[model samples]
Target: MAELIVQARWLVTGVQDRHTPIGIDDGAVLSRDGTIVATGLLDEMKRLAPTATVKTYPDHVMLPGFVNSHHHVGMTPLQLGSPDYALELWFAGRMPARRIDLYLDTLYSAFEMIASGVTTVQHIHGWMPGGYDAIHGAATKVLDAYRSIGMRASYCYAVREQNRLVYEDDETFCAKLPSPLGEELSAYLKAQAMPFSDFLKLFDQLTAENQGQRLTRIQLAPANLHWCSDESLVALHEKATAANVPMHMHLLETAYQKEYARRRTGKTAVRHLHDLGVLSPRMTLGHSVWMTQEDVDIAAQTGTCICHNCSSNFRLRSGIAPLNAFEKKGMTVGMGLDEAGINDDRDMLQELRLVLRAHRVPGMDDDDVPSCPQVLKMATESGAKTTAFGETIGKLEAGRGFDAVLLNWKTATYPFQDPDIPMLDAVMQRAKTNAVDAVFIDGEVVYADGRFTNIDRDAVLNEIADVLAKPRTPDEISRRNLGRAVFPHVKAFYDGYIGDGPVQPFYRQSSSV
Candidate 1:
């Protein structure tokens, strides 16, 4: 491939340097063979790569592509009418979604993410009831979609030995329900069950099958604390350690989860994981909204990463995460749009702004707030750490892949173009999906001028619509009805268990007034 030089009016390098600003005025990046060769002023880059083909964007700002650290099922749940219920109840409504073509489903969200400037995603695959063959096919289709879209993805099938749906065991939960519903749920759980050993074997199979894929890598997830038994957790840790791959799990995402940890292990989820010997730098805990200061300390000491899903927390009424505290503890916190953002879309730019404002704790002290640079890093470099890519794809430097997004300055930096205003702040606050002009991954332009180069966006959406237009099967209809019926019991169980009034918000205290 020929050398490529991309010049923009402004560039945000997303480099990890506290003393220096991330933006560079009149910046350019030079790349060849899918790797960036240099980043510097336009004239300097031109001098370095004198004969390279140049692409100039006089009215755009380039930044490292965003990474979504935790995601699952793409747009399946939302497209099928699952509202933003609490995590536990949401699963019930989501269970009935008609199985559409996995490739189209994955690409639907990939389009939204790429249009919103995201280049990497951590896809936590779960809830495939057809067992190993079904899951393997779905995983392969999802990976194919990502490859066709030219986006990097870290894929992991979530492993759960118990508590498939509700917090209680299947027998206990079924026993509490009426006769046929109980029988139906029990049978469903039985059908869905896969042994812990089988899941590990499947993981090894996938790793070997996709060993040299350019844009996709395999990882592991134990699902969550309550979902996995102690033996399963230890086994997962050992397997991941032996394989030298990252492990991500859902931990303390909701108040009930915190209580479950207390009831099940007599300790916090973080402490239990530490005891299980899984809280390492390779482990990333998703939606850590309800963790205490001590849990944060343990996470920091163990070099674990946290993926903060700001919109999912707010939409599901999962309290705000103590992101400020996490930062204070020097923990690596990455931003993620778990299911979708506040706008019910995977818009990373808006997600960034939401994260920047979410942690402002009504204090006049500027130190109490998250800066633009801090949030930018969370979306880029820090987020990359949560995926299998690690430090390879987050920054713009020599030897790093050219993964980036170009924002149209006309919309991103409009009305307030004062030179004194920080460019990064302006982009974060004002940029929207419409402002995204182009996106690149591994030195290739995947999306440009509202069109995807690798895949036919319109054709894929049309196919998905045609598939979804079909009537739901009898089994699917029954699942939907039963899920709705079971939701009340699930809610009541949690309500009775967490009877201590209301859980306080992370930043609020009872004596503050």
Candidate 2:
């Protein structure tokens, strides 16, 4: 049977040269066999698909589903109301104390994303131990969760090392550890020890394995700035060159990270990555909010993408990204809410609006620059391109995957000066997460009205509660066993935070099992 959906108003495509609306009224989309076969006026579509079942979305605004280019999906619940501190302090306090389970981990973040109308996301699974076994099991569960819920995803295995004790001066940390323990940790942390020769190898594996799946694509994300080295970064570049997989990484979002990169490499963070030869068309740098002009030029030249997380950057006081400048340079930028904090809200529309308003740099006005629809383009189509699914998804055209969002406009309708302006402006500024009336991926309606077709919402919520309520893992217990030693560092970290607020008081305590 043919499935048809008609909307009174919809963006049939992006705006044309004058940035004026190219969308049509009484727009309709027809699909069969999980593809958009036709899209035009209601009567035309009806004539095209005679005897087909039709669903009229009279007051709903239809648009391409939002794709969140950067996220850490399962890390949401553990760090709620965390101390409004720097990134280092947040990760230090938060990661060590919390425990996570598969079901809860999947449900908490997955539902949050779906609720926010983020049908596609790239979740960098970096928290677990960097070993084959540690990664596959937990990651599989998360992938299964996403698949079950009908969310599209680009799942990345973070390849790099982590320092357990950030407080110990580098020399002291190296010298004080028993040589054997140091060796073991060293081996574990060494980028040379990881599987997958390069980014391309990983991409080749993904394309090889995912023969039929349309919603999920695999990606390559180097763990973090500190975890990867010059050699490892080059390996990544080689892989990117070989397979053409999109490379995403956390970069210069934190002050300490900025300082560390400068002090260690004698260059800015983005410049250092460029020096390592990792800047290219396959690169999607997460949180390039702290980049310099030189860095922006490098990004533009190399055709690198920026996944802008407006709320997360400001919430953590990482400063606003130069969206206006990036757009002027013809660089493609996508909107994102980095996992946790105020970023936890999956509503990408709010994030998109914030991106437009937050970075107005002292001298620019609205008309002098891009419009809200351009930013929405970043959120929807550009986001899909930021990951491995660059060409496979995004726009709602024939032969592309049927990933789309149907928004409810009746609740938030307002008078507009020009009907020619795209619907994105309303969706960005006026609509809320609840306004997402329905979402579809691969022509299957995953979320409709207010419920998930593939998952039990309450059951998922309860699972997250259960996992968080469980006792911390053995490794966590060992870290807690070192609580006395860790406390001094934790205290010092909180004490030196720039904002003059009560540190621990800002955060809600984790509930004991």
User: lDDT winner among the candidates?
Assistant: 1
Give the Å shift of residue 123 in candidate 2.
1.1
lDDT of 2 by residue, 1-513 (tens): 646554456644543432453576668777776678877887887888877667677777777778888877565533642455556656544534566666467666777777666778887875555445545656677777788888888888776543433532434454545565445434433422445453345445555766687777777887667766677778777766776677788887765666667767899988888887788878888887667788889899989898888778877777666676688777888877777536556667677677766655444456545577777788777888897788667777766777777777866565432557446566667877777888878778888878889888888777667766777778776544443344355556435433453422111224458
What's the TM-score of each model vs. the native?
A: 0.96, 0.84
Please identify model 2 stretches exceeding 4 Å from their true place.
1-8, 15-21, 75-81, 162-208, 341-343, 367-370, 414-423, 470-484, 487-513
Off by over 4 Å in 1: 17-20, 501-505, 509-513
Q: In candidate 1, which residue pairs get closer than 3 Å at backbone N, Cα or C atoms, i.e. clash?
A: none
Inter-residue clash pairs, candidate 2: 199-239, 200-239
Q: lDDT of each model, Cα atoms only?
A: 0.87, 0.68
